[model samples]
Target chain A: MRQILSIATTTVGEAIRRRVLLIILLIGVLFLVVAPGLGVLSARSETVVLRGMMLGIIQLTSAVIAIVLTVYMIPNEIERRTIYTILSKPVQRWQFLIGKYLGAVFSLGLMMALMTAVLVFVFWLQASDQSLAAVGAMVKAPTMYFVQMSLLAAVAIFFSTFVAPLVNFFLTGGMYLLGSLFNPFFQTLQENQGTHPVTKAFAGIVNTILPNFANYNVQNPIINPTQVIQNESRYYLEVTFYGLFYIGILLVAGILIFDRREV
Target chain B: MAAAIETKQLTKSYKSRAAGNINVVDNLDLHVEEGEIFGFLGPNGAGKTTTIKMLLGIIYPTSGEGFVLGKEIGDMAVHRLISYLPERPYYYEHMTGLELLKFYGSLFGIYDEAKYRALLEKVNLHRDMTKTISQYSKGMQQRVGLAQSLLNDPKLLFLDEPTGGLDPIAHREIRDLILSFRDEGRTVFISSHELSEVELICDRVAIINKGIIERQGKLTELLHGGRIEITVGGVDEAFLKGLNIPDSNIRGLPVGVLMDMPEEQDPNGIIDAVRNRKGTVISVVPRRKRLEDLFVETVTNPALGGKPSVPPAVAEEIVK
Candidate 1:
């Protein structure tokens, strides 16, 4: 545990200082600050459009940050020979993998927290007629996006143990896209009575294999205040646990591969 | 002395599409006694690093067995007593020398600030303890690496090219520190290409070529059959050769002649001949066979333990 924490803290220190991640974060913040002006062009209510646009920027930015941060996490350590120094010590391979994953999560959370703060300030500054309760509700989506990005980091880390950074980048990005956009379309197809048995079976297997990133996507209800979710807190808890469970499995698989890898 | 490390038929092989089952480290045996500096010498891609990694438990051996500190290889209990510093290691640049030590120290659950300070002082990095690795010179980085390797007060230290690519002063500094490891009763295993550096520090050495142990013995035993040189000022190369000294090299110097021959041969017969010719005998010097000569002879020739083997392609390349 001590070894894992030490590696984790060191990883966090390195990740936060990376110029590429900081640049991505800066761009995310910039878009959030300017989102209110763009909301006026949309046909919907200005505040509603502003809410959706800001949340969309945060989700997109977090996904990119998660992928970029984790793709090279294992490979860079090997290339730089840092992993040898640590592994030659009493540290276990699983501990190092978990420590690195946690470090990526912590760094991602820090970046998302910054964007979330910016979102609040932007909403408060531009949507002044809105109530404080509305602002609080708006804060919930970025919080869930944090868990979504954490899962995404885990996906990248799992692939990184076996694949090169470039390939892992595309693979993890593709997984995210499939889970976010097409997962629901597939889910609906599987449930609809008129769907073919073959298509339903395929959807079932895909759903079973791919993590439902759409689980944490609670932006629509927050975007339009008229919508109501009866079991809001229960749903939040279930998705957070689901993300954690999936992250756990991916990490275990990654550690198994990394243990045998002759780095 | 008890053996600190011993191996029997330890091997590591990799399979490739074109070439099948290439043995990076073939059936090999090695021995390192407790509290001695053992030099592991080899050319590039000669399996020095692979052997070290297997011993360190960073990678598994394909077949065979090994022991470290009287424990089986890859034992976690053994790791607590051992440390490894690889070639050209990169410390976390964001960390100060002190912080780097702290982080590695924490791996062993050690939180003693005084120990960290003492280690820095031992490596002569006490003043630079607060400086991040990015600000340190190459020598300083290597020094800090040594400091971290000592965090556990290890019984064995494996250093791969500890003084590689450093200036004279830095080399001397690192060499002195390695020698001090022996004094402190620590077993030091070094894999290096710096022959002169190894000659200065290593108590015993093993030369491996193409993953096979070609030579292994004490420094003094392996380096034998030294040469004797007799220099005369007035004598020319032609006159020196005329003496017909057997098993000797007669060469012309800028202002004199030099006769180099085996150590067992007498120097008086040559001295009398040079004096009778009025060729002033300027000097007589006995030179021991150097490690470099032994390395070239052992690596280039395929014979080991009186058994002939195939020469490596790299050795042939060297001949060219």
Candidate 2:
């Protein structure tokens, strides 16, 4: 356990030292500043514009955080031969993988929190004359966004364990895109199933394997305020649980693959 | 007593993309007793680093087996007893020297910071402990690398070119440190291209070439006993022409008459030749062979010409 903690701390220290954390912060701040400008010419209501901006920022920040951090961690260590010092010890390979995953997750978690704060602040600024209930709804949307990003981070780690960082980045990014596009594609297939049973079945199989990123997207409720579904917290919580479950499974797979890696 | 390290037909071959398979380490056997500084000598790309990496379990061998502290290597438990210093010292550049040591110690399950601190002081790195490793000089980095290897006070230490970049003083300090480790009953396996340094510190040495153990034994046994120089005065070129010494026996002359003579072989014949002359004998100097010359001779040609298995007993006694 202590060894895992040591590995974790080292991984975190390495991540911070690489200025990855700083870059994430800079991107998040930039997104927050630009999000309000989209409201100016939009035909959508102010609440809707704010919510869209919040959702866009969350998705963009989470995807970047997951892909960038996961891609570099293992490759950098192998290049530096730091992995040798750690592997020479009595520690197991699985421990090293888990420790790295958990450490990177911690870094991503911190970035998500900071981005969430900026999001809330932006929503508050746009809600000057609005009711507290409306502002509260806007603030609540990001909770689901965090769960989605955490899941993406786990998938990125899984790819990193077996492939090079650049390939891993492309793979995880593609998966994130697929996950986001899956819901609408699946719904369309289901609606046309009377004439397209084969296409519907293929969509069903992909839906089962890929994460349902769209389920955690709550931006519409924040933007259209009137669309806020009351007592829908249970659905949000279930999605969060689902995200955690997938992250856990992917993390286990990553550990197994990493253990067999010769390095 | 068990051998500190032993390998039986250990081999490793790397598969190359641009070329055919290259055997980095061929089927080879080796053994080093406990408390001995065993020098693993080989030229660059002679599989020296590969052998060390296999011993540390950093890489798996293509075939054969090895044991460290009587436990089969590439096993997690055996790795715990071994400490390795790579040829090029690389650490967490962002970490301070002390922090790097502490981190390595922690991985080895050494929780006490005090113990690691003492090790740093022992390696003469306590003063540089707080400075980031990136800011340190090459010598200082090497010292910290040495200190890190000693973090757990491992029974078997694998050092790959520990003195490569060190200054003369730093090199001596490291050599003394290695000697001290042996004195404490620990075993050190050192790989180096520096033959003289190896000869100076190693209890026994193994010379590997093309992934095979070319020679292995105590330093003394490998070197030839000595050379004999018989200088005769008052004998002109006419008398010298009458002598029947083989060209192989003559080692050139400012000081004349060089010959490799056995100790037991009677010096009477040569003495007679000089005494019978109308001239005086200047000197007969017996010179013992240096390690470097022996190393060159053995490595160049292990077959020291198909003479007798042993040299004459008298000359051997003089060397002993």
Candidate 3:
């Protein structure tokens, strides 16, 4: 645990200093600050448009940061020969993988938090819903996005153990897109009896294999202000546990491949 | 003395589509006695680093077994007693020297501030403890590497190219520190191409070519059989040439006629031949064998398929 924490802390320090992630974060913050103007262009209520736009910026930026940060974490260490020094110690491959994964999570959380602060200040300044409950409600989606991005980081880290950074970048991004935009479509296809059996089996395989990244985005109702989830607290807990379970599986799988890998 | 490192038939191979399996470190036997500096010498792609990696458990052997400090390879318990500093080592540039030490020290569950400071001081980087790694010079970085490798007070230290690409001052500094490690009773296993450096500090050395141990033994034993030089005055160069000594060179020095002959030749016979010509003997100097000669002979034996470090023409010129 001591070795893990030391590696984790060092990784976090290095990650936050990476200029590319900071640039992605800066772009996300800039868009959120100007979201009020874009809100007026939409036909819907200004608060709804502004909230939806800001949340989208935060989610997209956090996802990019998560993927970019993790895809090169292991490869860079190996290339730079840093892994030789660390692994030569008493550190295990599992501890190293977990530490790197946690560091990515911590760095993504920091960037997302900065973007969220801008979202709150912008939303409060533009919307008439000035209640603390309104701000609390607005913050919930980004909080869930943190867990969502953590899972995405795990996916990227796992691929990084076996693939090159460029390939892992595209692979993780494709998985995220599939899980977010098409996961529901696949899940529905598996459930609807009218669907072809051949298609159903394929859908079932993909749905089971791909993480349900959409579960975290289910908090979209928080920003839309009209839709309500039944038993909101219970649903949030279940989704968080679901994310944790997937992350645990990905890390263990990554550790197994990485242990046998020759650096 | 107990063996600090031992390997029996340790082999690591990679599958190549074009050529079947290429054994990188093939069927090798190696031994290192405790508390001695052992130099592992080999040309590029001679499996030096691969062998070191396998011994350190950074990479696995496809077949065979290796042990470090009485424990099986890859055993984490042995890691607690060993450290490795690789070629051109890199530390986190964001960290000051002190922070870097603290970071590596924490890996061993050692967080003593005084110990870290003393290590830096030992490596002569005590004043640079607060300077980030990005600011350290190449020599300073190597010194810092040495400092971190000492964090565990390891029983065995594996250093790959420890003094590579450094100036004379830095080289001497690092060399002295490595010598001190042996004096302190720590076994140092160094993989280097610096034969002269190895000749100076190593107690034993093993030369590997094509992933095979071609030669392994004490430096004194391996470097024996040097040539002898006899310089005589009042003797014509033709007088020494007339001797027609096999595999010997007769040349003229400003001071006298010089005859350079192999160590296996009887110097008494050569001296009598010179005296029969009434030659005045100036001096008889024994030219000790160099690691360079042995390395060239082993690595470039036409059978080994290694390109000669010395061109064929140059070798024939000296022999003639």
Candidate 4:
């Protein structure tokens, strides 16, 4: 456990200092700060537009950050020969893989936290009604996005063990897109009684294999007061649990492959 | 002394689409006793690093067995007693020297500040502890690598090219530290291309070529068969050659006929013949064989074969 934490700590340190991640984060913050002015151009309510725009920026930024941070996590260690030094110690391969995954998630959380802080401050500064409750509600979507991104990082890490960084980058990004945009469509298709059996079977396979990133897209309820999540606490807990379970499986698979990998 | 490391036909092979089943390290049998600096020498791609990785349990052998500290390879218990510093190792550049040591030390669940400090002092990097790795010179990075390797106070230290690509002063500094490992009763297994550096520090060496052990023995015994060069002025090349010295080369220079002969044969006879023939014995120099010569000879010649070819006396002494 200590070895894992040591490797985790080092990974976090290296990840945070990576200039590419910092640049993406800076851009995310910039967009959040300027989102209110852009809301003026929208036909929807200014608050609604502002809220939706800021949440979109945060989600997109976090997804990109998660993918970029994790795809090279294993490859960079091997390229720099840092993995050899650490592996040559008493540390196990699973520990190193878990440590790197945890570090990526932690660094992602830190960057997302910064963007959330900026989002809160920008929303607060621009709002007509300033309520602590409103700000608190605004932070919840990012919290869930943190879980979604954590799962995304795990997927990237799993592919990183067996694939090159460039391929893993596209693979994890594609997984995220399919899960986020198409999971609901597949879920509905699988449930439709009148649907063709072959199509339903295909949908069932996609739905079963892909993580439901849309489950954590709880922004619509928070952004528009008219919409509400039915049994909000149960929904939040269920999705978070789902994310963790999926992440656990992906990590186990990664550890198994990494244990046998030459690097 | 007991063996610190022992291997039996340890092999690591990789299959390629173009080549089909390439043995990077084939049927490698190696031995290293405790408390000695054993040099693992070979040319590039000779599988020195591959062999070390297998022994360190970083990678598994395709076939055969290896033991370290009397435990099977990959035994975590033995890892607690061993450390490996790879060729051209890279530490986290974002970390300061002290923090780097702390990080590696924490791997063994060791958080001792005093130990980290003392190790830095041992590697002569205590003053640079505050500096991040990016601010360090190549030598400083290597010194810090040494310091981190000692964090566990390991019984066996595997250093791959410990002094590679360093200046003379840094080379000497690392060499001295490695020698100190032996004095402190630690086994140092070094895989290096620096034959001269290995010659200076290693008690025993194994030279590998094309994934096979070509020669293995004590440095002194393997480097035997040095030559004697007798330079005689006022002597014709034909006259020197007519002396019929065995395993000798005679070259005619403008000022002298140089007769290079085996060191075992008495050179005094050649010198006497040259003088009696009215030739001035310009100079007589006995050149002892160096480790570099032996390494080149062993690696360049396939006939030396992959086995211990130690002189009979030295072989017996090593056995006892």
Candidate 5:
């Protein structure tokens, strides 16, 4: 455990210092700060448009950070020969994999937290008339987005063990898109009475295999004042559990593949 | 002394489109006793790194057995007693020299600041402990690498090209450090192309070529049969021949005669004969057979199929 933590801590230190990640994070923060101005042109209520835009910016930026941070995690170690030194120690391959994954997730969380903080300050300044409870409620979406991006980082980490960084980049991005946008469609198609058996079976397989990234997109309820989840805390807990469970599976599979791999 | 590392018929094979399964390290048999610096010498594509990787368990061997510290290869218990410093090693640039040692030390559950500091000091990097790796020179990085490799206090150290691409001072510093490892009773297995460096430090050596172990033995044993050259003035070839030196090559020069004899022969006899014949002795040069000559002979010999052999002089030196 100590070995894993040391590797994890070192990885986080390196990841946070990476110029590309910091630049992506800066661009995200800049967009969130400018989002209120863009919300003025929207046809919807100003608060609703601003909330949606800010959440969109956070989600998009976090996704990019997660992908970019993790896609090269394994490859960079091999390229720089750092993996040779680490593996030559008593450290197991699984420990190294888990440590790298945790580091990526931690770095992603830090970047997401900064964007969230900016989102809160901007929303608070724009809607001072709103209650503190309402502002706190607005922070919940990014909290869930953090869990969502952690899952995304895990997806990238898993693919990175076997594939090149460029290929893993596209592969992880494609999975995120499919899971976030089309997962529900696939789920719905599988349950529809009119759906063909072959299509239903295929949808069922994909829905089962791909993580339900959309489960954590709780912005809909938080964005519109009228919308509400029946049991908010229970819903959050369930989705958080689902994300953790999926992440566990991906890491386990990745460890198995990396154990036999020659670096 | 127990064998620190032993491999029997160890092999690693890869498939290629041009050829079928090719062994990168083929049926290799090697042995290194405890508390000695053993040099693994080979050409660029001689599978030196592959052999190290297999012994370190970083890669699996295709077929065969290898033991480190008397445990089977890939056993984690053996890892606790071993450390590897790869060719042109890289450490985390963001880490200061001290922090880098701490990080590697933590791998073995060691967190002693004093030990880390001492290791840096030993490598002569204690002064630069606060400098991040990026601020370091190439030599400093390598010194820091050595510092980290000692974090676990390993019994066996695998150093691949420990002094590669360094200046003379860095080279000497690293060489001294490696010699210290052996003096401290640690088995050092080095894979390097630096024949002169190896010659200076290694007690024994093995030369590999095209995935095969061509020669393996003590440096003194492998580097045997040097030649003795005697240059003299005013001595006729007939007079030198009359002295009747066996297995000697006597060439006539403008000034006198030159006698090239095996080192085993007494040079005093030839000098005495030259003097008695009224010849003035110019010089007696003992051409010790170098590792480089033996290496070239072994690596390029068509008879051994690119295996190890002594040069013509050493071979003749042996015959005499």
Candidate 6:
């Protein structure tokens, strides 16, 4: 446990020193500041437009941050031969994977919190009237975004354990795109049940294997105050837990493969 | 006593589909006794690094069993008691020397900062501990590398070209440190192309060539074969006549001549041969067998000329 924490701390320190976390934070803040101005030019309702823009920005930024940082964690260590120094110890392979994952997640979590705070501040500045429920709903979008990014980070790490960083980057991004498209395909399959059995079955298998990142998109519930937040809280927590579970599975697989690699 | 390290028929082959396969190490046996400085001498492409990697469990051997500290080579517990320094030390460039040492110490489960601090002092790296490893000279990096190896106070240490790039003073310091390790009853296994350094520090030395052990034994046994050189000027025929040395004893050289005496023969016979001659003797230098000469002779001769057979007892003893 101590070794894990030590490794995580070192990872965090390395990330901070490299200015990766700082770059992500600066970009996220800039996006939040500019999001409200973009909402003003939209042809839709003001609150709804602002919420959609904020959610889209958060998702895009978080994905960029997670993929860019996590993809190089293992590869950089291997290239530098720092893995040799760490693996020579009594620490298990699983511990090293978990430690790196947690470190990356923590870094992303810090960025998410900072970006979400900036978005909330912008929302508060533009609001004519604020309610407790409205504020809570507005915060849920970035919170869900955090969970999705954490899952993406794990996916990047999993691929990094076995392949090159550039390949892992594209592979994890492809998985994310495929996972996000799952919900629409599932709805389509349900609408055309008689026509698309084989396609529906294949989509179902992919949905089961990859994380459903689209499920965490909760912008409409917060933006359109007329619509009830049906299943919002339960689904948000459930999807967060689901992302955590997927991360755990990928991390285990990574550990297994990395353990057998001759370093 | 059990051997500190032993390998039986150790072999390793690297396979690449695009390129021709090459066997880095093949059908080799090696043993090092506890408290002895064993030198593993080989030229470039001689599988020295490959053998070290296998012993350290960085790379698995294709076929063989190796033991260290009476335990199997790959065992983690045995690894804890063994320290290694690679030919080129690679470290985190961002980390200072002290930070790197602390990280290594933490991995080895050593929490005492003072002990590591003292090790830095011992390796003469205390002054440069605050500087990043990337900024260090090759010799300075080697010093830090040596410091890290001694962090756990290991029972066995493997150093590959430990003093390869060091200046004369640093090289001497490292040699002294290795000798000190032997004095404290720890085993030190070193691989180097520096024949003179190996000869100076190693109690027992092994000369490997083409993935095989050409000769291995006590330094004294290899060096004390009793070869001498004699030089004299004027009256060549008279000097030859005065010396009744057999043909086997007298071998011709470019400048002067070489004399090979039986193991039991005294130097007095050569002294008498020159003394009774009607000529002024310039110099009668008694040539002792050096590790460099031995290395050159063994490597140049595919079948070393009438070399003494390696005793089976020595091989068996190292295995145990």
State TM-scores per candidate.
Answer: 0.92, 0.84, 0.93, 0.91, 0.96, 0.84
Instruction: Evaluate model 2: give its TM-score.
Output: 0.84
TM-score of chain B of 4: 0.83
- Between prediction 2 and prediction 6, which has the larger DockQ? 2
Candidate closest to the true structure, highest DockQ: 5
Docking class of 4: medium
lDDT of 2 by residue, A1-263 (tens): 87888888887787766676577768777878777887776887766676787667776877787778888888777777777767777877778877887788777777777777777777777767566776667566666777777788788888888898888888988998888877667756766737477887887777778888888777776666468666797888788888999998998898888876766
Clashing pairs in 1: none
DockQ of predicted candidate 3: 0.84
Off by over 4 Å in 3: B234-254, B261-281, B303-320
Cα lDDT tens digits, model 4, B1-320, are 89999999999999999999998998999999999999998777789999999998989999999999999999988988999898898889999999999999899989999999999999998888999999999999999999998988899999999988899999999999999999999999999877778888999999887678888888878888999998998779999888898999989877788889998899888888888988799888989998876766666554667444344443233222
lDDT at position B231, candidate 2 = 67
As for candidate 6, its interface RMSD to one decimal place is 2.3
Interface Cα RMSD in Å, per prediction:
0.7, 1.6, 0.6, 0.8, 0.6, 2.3
Predicted candidate 6 versus true structure: per-residue lDDT over A35-73, tens digit per residue: 878887978888788877877887888898899999999
N/CA/C clash count, model 4: 1
The list of candidate 2 runs beyond 4 A from truth reads A41-43, A129-143, A187-197, A229-231, B16-22, B224-248, B251-320
Interface RMSD of 4: 0.8
The CA-based lDDT of model 3 is what? 0.90
Error of model 4, residue B256, in angstroms: 10
DockQ, prediction 1: 0.74
Instruction: Output the lDDT of residue B219, model 3.
Output: 94
TM-score of chain A of each: 0.96, 0.88, 0.97, 0.98, 0.97, 0.92
Write the residue-wise lDDT of candidate 3 on A159-260 in tens digits.
Answer: 999999999999999999999989999999999989999999999999999999999896568766678988999999999999999999999999999999
* Tens digit per residue, CA lDDT, model 6, B1-320: 66998999998888889876767787779989998999998666678877887887767888988888888877888767888887777777778889888877876778888987899998888899999988998888888988888888989989889988688988998888888898888999999877888989999998776677888889999887655555555435445544665533554455555555544455577656666755445565666778876777666665753334334443233222
Chain B TM-score (each prediction, in order): 0.85, 0.79, 0.86, 0.83, 0.92, 0.83
Q: What is the C-alpha lDDT of each candidate?
A: 0.91, 0.76, 0.90, 0.91, 0.91, 0.78
Candidate 2: clashing pairs of residues: A47-A223, A48-A223, B263-B314, B263-B315, B264-B314
Model 5 lDDT per residue over B1-320, tens place: 89999999999999999999998899999999999999998777789999999999999999999999999999998889999999998899999999998899999999899999999999998889999999999999988988888888999999998988899999999999999999899999999878889999999999887899989999998998999999899878788777777888989877767889888899998888778877799999999999988887787685775444445564434222
